[model samples]
Target: MKVFDIIIQAMLSLRSNLLRSWLTTMGVAVGVFSIIAVMTALQAIDRSVAAGLSSLGANTFEIQKYPAAFFGGHGRNRFINRPDITYEEGLAFKRLMQEEARNIGLKVSRSGNQATYRNRSTNPDVVMVGADENFTAANGFDIQQGRNLVEQDILYARNVILIGHEVYTTLFPQRSDPTEQLLRINDDVYRIIGILARKGAAFGQSQDNLVVIPITRYRAHIDSRQSVGITVEASSRSTYSSTLDQAVGAMRTARGLTIRQENDFELRTNESLVESFRDFRQTISIGAFIISFMALVTAGVGIMNIMLVSVTERTREIGIRKSIGAPGATILQQFLLEALFLSLTGGAIGIMAGTGAGNLIAIAFNLPPILPWLWIGIAIAVCSAIGISFGIFPAYKAASLDPVDALRAR
Candidate 1:
């Protein structure tokens, strides 16, 4: 018999036990589904976060009291013990980098404040930030209406504020421009001088839900104990690296950190943040791979068991084929093909289902759809190998049956 004939016969044998074949295929399908679903969601989330992080601008870095992110207990304890970055220290650093850096901004933030304009009041989810004149340009925010904060606003601690896109929409739901309007923040009142353009969410947190006021005003009115963060912008793309180095030195000196003592402040740049996210992405990818691997192995085992049963039940038929002068190799090929057909069918079904399910989750999170073609190809190849590996023993057993003994047996 030709190879094609063997495959056809094998398929026919599988058709004789349709339910069992489908069950075996489903096992492999589930394995493919798990990894594909996870990968699709992860890819979408990564894209969304990358776009948000890019909005922080490539020429800027921030100096804060603690690291941008923390790991385990040791990491948390280390940052917790560090002193707060005070507003005075931020000013001193700014002065030291006067000639080297293009712009330096000092800022402090407090969250959970209700903004009220007459009887309309927002939820206590608003973030109120105290920022210097340079904050808007340094942080890559554009003034949509009216003007940005000026030096006089920060120096005199003026009662002026810049409302974010979300704040404007919430306070003035009619979509009217809110410039010059008096916004009541808690017990204090500030005139809105500008509105910020809409900035979407970053890491699942809305960037447009906060309000910005002069840092000097925030220190006097809000809590003075909170640390102030300093944002430094490089003079040019060529000077960015040297500028960062200078800022680091200036900050350490301003904070009075001796050479022997490690610097207590944290410096975060766009590249560093991207590198951190890359590491996190790798960890997630490894976990997904391991989980899928285990599932695929279990499915492969199912294929082996089912194929073994098939060989045993067809012993008499096998003997008759052997008696009719069919080659042992042909018998082996038929059994192996049957197992391969089961695995590949399951894999195809799994790929479709997994891709659809994964993309749906991405849509829910407002992320673009991601199709994992590479993983799909890998899955199909893996399924083929699994089918061959599991089918080998059963194929060899059927091929080795003695014709005389097999014919007399059942």
Candidate 2:
């Protein structure tokens, strides 16, 4: 038989048992959905992490009391008991690295606070950060209106704040310029000295739901026990490693660490952050792949059972065709095509549904939509392979049946 005729015959056979065919296809659909949905979501997350980390600008690193992330295992106690990087130590390190660094920024942050302007108030999801003049340049935040906090503001502990785009829009819904206005944080009323240009989102959270105050004021008015985090900008990319070394040595000296004592603080850069995320993403991807593989294997078994039943029911038809000069190869081809069609149909539907679901999640998290075409293509290929692998035995049985016996029995 011609290829097209075989395909048409295969499709007709499936259509004749529409309900059974659909149920069988559903198994494959679910399997494909599991693989595609998670892979799509992970692709979007990878894209978001890359974009977010790059937003911190180039040739920069931070020193803090704890690592940016911790993978649970041994040595948790050491990090837990490490001393906080004090404000005094931060300044002394700043003074020590003045000539070696291009720009040094100090910041401390507290989250889950409300900011009120007049009768309008933001949800308690607002984040309050204390920073100096270098914060804008070091962190790559641009002032949309008014000016960033100057050194004098931090030195004198001014009661002024810079609002992020989300905070500004939420508090001043009318789009009015918020500069020179007063906003209340706790019992303290602060002047809105500037509005930050929209910086978008990072890792599913808004980067713009924050308020910035001077570091000195943050120490004076807010919790003083929290460690200060310091950002150090290398003079150039080539010197970044050297600058990090200088920062480590300077921080050790400022904190009075001996040569034998291991450094208590953690230092991280954009490169390290990206590497950490890559490892995290890989671990999650492997887990998802394993789960999806199991589902697909289950679906393959279902396809095999359904195809075997199809062969049994069509034995007389196969006998009649073989009796009329039909080749065993043609019989095998017909059954194989039927199975392939079922799997591909399910796979096509699953791809559409999975992509839509993944994109919906991405939208909810405010991440850019990412279509993993490579994965989609691979899914379809896998579906085809599964169909051929599961259908071959049944197709071979149908093709090898004795024509007289099959005809006589049925």
Residue pairs with clashing backbones, model 2: none
TM-score for each candidate, following the candidate numbering: 0.85, 0.94
Off by over 4 Å in 1: 1-19, 111-125, 170-173, 184-189, 317-334, 348-366, 399-409
Evaluate all candidate structures by whole-model CA lDDT and list the values in order: 0.87, 0.88
For all predictions, the C-alpha RMSD in Å is 3.3, 1.9
Q: Judged by lDDT against the true structure, how good is candidate 1? A: 0.87
The candidate maximizing TM-score is: 2
- Highest-scoring model, lDDT: 2
Residues 191-298 of candidate 1 have per-residue lDDT tens digits of 999999997877546788899999988988887889989988898889999999998899999999999999898888777677777787788889888988888899
Mark the regions of model 2 whose C-alpha exceeds 4 Å error after superposition: 71-74
